[model samples]
Target chain A: MPKLSYLKALHRALRDEMDRDESVFVLGEDMNFALTNTTSGFLDRFGADRVLEMPLSEQGFTNFATGAALAGRRPVVEFQIPFLLLLVFEQITNQANKFLLMSGGQRSVPVTYLMPAGGHRPGWGAQHSDQPYSLFAHMGVKTVLPATPTDAYGLLTTAIRDDDPVVVIGPLACLGVREDVDHADLVPVPLGKGRIHRAGTDVTLVATGHLVHEAIAVADDLAGDISVEVFDPRTVYPFDWDLLAESVGRTGRLVVADDTNRFSGLGAEVLATAAEELPLRVPPKRVSRPDGAVVGAAPELDAVLQPTREQIADAVRSVLKESGWGA
Target chain B: MSVLDEVPATEADSAVPDSAALYRTIRFIRRFEERAVELVKAGEIRSGIHPCIGQEAVAAGAVATLDADDVVLSSHRGHGHLLAKGCDPARLMAELAGRATGIDRGRGGSFHPSDFSANVFNATGTVGHGAAIAAGIGWAAATAGSPRVVLSFFGDGAVSQGALLEGFNLAALWRLPVVYVCENNGYATTLPAGAAIAGTVVGRGEAFGIPSSSVDGQDAETVYAAVREAVVRARSGGGPSLLEMRTYRYHGHHTFELKTRLRYREQSEVDSWLGRDPLLIQAARVAEDERARVDAEVEARLDEVVRFAVASPYPDPATATDHLHADGLRPRPGSAR
Candidate 1:
């Protein structure tokens, strides 16, 4: 079994897809130079025609990818900075996302907006730190936030091949996480499917993106008193609520860990939907950054702004206590 | 059926538009816009259209030079572009009327209709954004080893958008087969070009090292010659070119202006542009018998077009949000389920 890090998984998925489909081309700033290491050595392998190096024109290139996709060429656009997504949100959300509907399904834009260092890298201030998968998801764009190496490779591979626009966010924090992998186990993960990493009869901890790792660790630490189930809904939009309902029904408790703003974030949507539709013994709990959070430059500030494992552990016990069950 | 004059196989593949066929195209767009305006007033067209009434030659002349298979990216005032590019008049009228028989199946109204048969990929209402999409299509065609050139049409206002200039840079850098036509129609909504643009229009294209020229948009032949040269250059892998068409619209920016009664341009300035009307300019070039025949035929054809548009059924409400995703994922209902 080879140890596959999350970064390698993302890089490998892009390399493999381009190899599989000649129509799959990459365009972004400094792609030939491999600024994000995702397209490292791509220029030499695919030649200058396939790997396009764009100028520092985000909006132009974003819509350019949309146009290319309209002409039957699959474009995987990689943006190094997460905030650049905000800059070109209109191109993705308004243009590429709506083309299929607006064109009456006559044309489909199969462009993959790949954000390599999504959400808060170390020392990068407020401008660069944002996990905006919720933004794309809200606009009905298929959004993928993978928590593990295998899931990263699977989900991203699926995104590039999709006939519509998809946003694949490789969370900066999950890049270093590694796992032993059997190459046969590496496969395309279907969107809107939840993976139950650990099963239990007690509370169900539904975590998103990089926070899924923190959630699993918290479940292990509280193994003595509470039986916790850790579930990761890798793709946020078109969420697998049926899978979520079954887990919550078994546990009779629900808690969400998310790496976004407290208000209207992924965690809020999970709890809101569960509270409105799913069976729950007690009120659902959510651990997320404060409302409209702006992560500062310092590491301590980043940690303070991020959801922690201790917070997830406490939320699980508190939900049980609220239910008047043994905490 | 297509009411507009579609060139014959011989003329379609010709390097330039035949004078008579070109006159019919300009005349067709002129009559089509007039009928659309009437439909807007009759309450059939819920969203009043942007009438490119006087700027017909730019669409007719420019589109005449290209092959029927080449792609086009249009703007908000795009009926002229679409009609000249060979979209069925009845379907286009139905699209304006928000009918199920529209080119976009009523998903996109007059503002965003895309006719794949005509090679007119959907119009972007956002100003200047179509340029980038055109460049992208151009790049894709070149990459696929296809000789298809892309034509992007926009107004004077689009020149200032950062994305449009960036689009220029990309097309010039990659030597993509795209022709950008700027209809400098004196004003954008209400602001005059003198107040809106900083430097000259051709300078924007020249700054990117693209072959840039300004043409008299009122004469159909002048526009045809300029676009034909650009198309020839693009088809031969000579990169992109920009042509600034000095044209003016006879009507207000949109039909909404009919109610607002806004007074921006002087009456004298309005009368001056009306004198050089592109339709009349081309009408003179054709034989009197031919011109009168096209006129009678176009008016009679538009009557049926209007009937088809108003009589077409509206789409079912159940499918209002259909075709949103390729994978067929539905959003949760708005009300409590």
Candidate 2:
């Protein structure tokens, strides 16, 4: 067994995939020095041509990756900041995402948009802090937010292999987490699947990205009082509804913990869908950042803006406390 | 299909008098825009088109030099490029009408029409993004030992975009078989090229060491001569060439501008360019009887095209996710139960 840090898992996946398929190569800014740490040792392992360092042109490089993909090469683009994704949104959503459909099934853009440090990083200020995986999912781009080291490795490998444009949001909180695993067990996981971290009967807590670990801790803390089922959706856009339905069917209640803004966030979609179709005994609840939240530089302000573990526990308990069934 | 067999060190002159082909291309483009404008006025097309009214010669001349296997990537104002690439007018019209018989099966409307079978990829609404896609196609073609060239068309406004310049760097560095044709049509929507652009459009490509030049885009004959040379250079392993076709738009940037009442280009300037119209320039070269025959043939073809487009059906809503992926997998419906 080897200790695999979340970042290491990402490095392993990139190295393995590039080794397995010669078409796999990386392009990004400051990638020569491994700025985001995901591309650490990449330049050394794969020469400069395979590990390309680009200029400060987000829109340009994003489309360049699209072109490279069209050239029969699989490109993995690394974005240092989350907001850079916002700058090149049109390139991804309009150009890369629309090619296959617009070409009437004549072309495919197999490009991966990897955001290494996604979500709020305290003291990084307003412009830097954002968790926008939900935006990609909403635009119908393949979005994956893995919860653990193994899932991160598996999902990233799968994203690079996918025929369409895919976005992988690696949350900041999950970067430090580590797990013991067999190196041989490292494999590509299928997209659009969910794994139940912990199964219980009282309430089904749907958590994503870094919040999945928080949810597992909360479930353990209240293990004696309430039965909590913690579910992590590895892929958000083409979400595994069958697995979610099965989890909620046993619990009869739902709670979602997300790191995105409250308005039209993934959390809202989750709770809305669950309430409408699932036979929940009580009203579903979601804990997320305040509407249009901008994570500030101050530690206290950032903490207050983010969804907390206590908030998740309270939301779960509240959903459990509700007495009435569907009106 | 592989038309350019040898690379010429200097610009190549057309062996055949290319006025007829150039005129037919420009005429098809002009008529296509006119019909699309009618559809836009009727509200049948939701996204108002960025009509390439006066900038037809650039597309006609550049695309005329390309082979059937060559790729053409275009910008938002791309009806001219489509027509020059020999895209069927009826299917293009149907795409504007949101009918399933369209090249994109009605998925792409005005800003994003694509026909990959003809090697005409989508003309992205995003400015300057098509350069990279075209470069990619060129790189792929060259790697596979195919002498296939890619012609990417953009406006003078795209020169300011960093992405377009980045594409220049990549194409020049790799010696990719690509030709970047910048149609300097004076205005990008309301802003004049002088106001939006800082330096010369040809200078941007020259900065990247790509063989760059400026040509009279208004004259179909001149444009055809310049593009033929570039195509010969690309096919002969000479790498990329950039041509800045100095032209002007006769109409507003988009048809919607006709409603907004903006004074961007003067009536006199537009009239001066229209006087040297590619349609008349090439038509004058042909005999009077041949010109009449070409006109009658064009009119009959357009009528049939309109009939086909109007009769085509709208795509079914159930297959909304079709062609999103090359693997042909539709995304699972948003989970409710």
In the order shown, the chain A TM-scores of the predictions are 0.97, 0.98
Write down the lDDT that model 2 would get.
0.84
TM-score of chain B of each: 0.98, 0.92
Question: Which sections of candidate 1 miss by over 4 Å?
Answer: A324-327, B4-6, B12-16
Among the numbered candidates, top DockQ falls to 1
What proportion of the real contacts between chains A and B does each prediction keep?
A: 0.82, 0.72
TM-score for all predictions? 0.98, 0.89
Say which candidate scores most in TM-score. Answer: 1
Prediction 1 TM-score vs. true: 0.98
Against the native complex, each candidate's DockQ, computed on alpha carbons, is: 0.85, 0.51
* Candidate 2, residue B104: how far the Cα is off, in Å: 0.7
Give candidate 2's error at residue A55 in angstroms. Answer: 1.5
Per-residue alpha-carbon lDDT of candidate 1 for residues A42-96, written as tens digits (9 for 90 to 100): 9999998899998899999999999999999999999999999999999999999
Q: What are the per-residue Cα lDDT tens digits for candidate 2 across A3-58?
A: 99999999889889999998888989999899888988888898986898887877
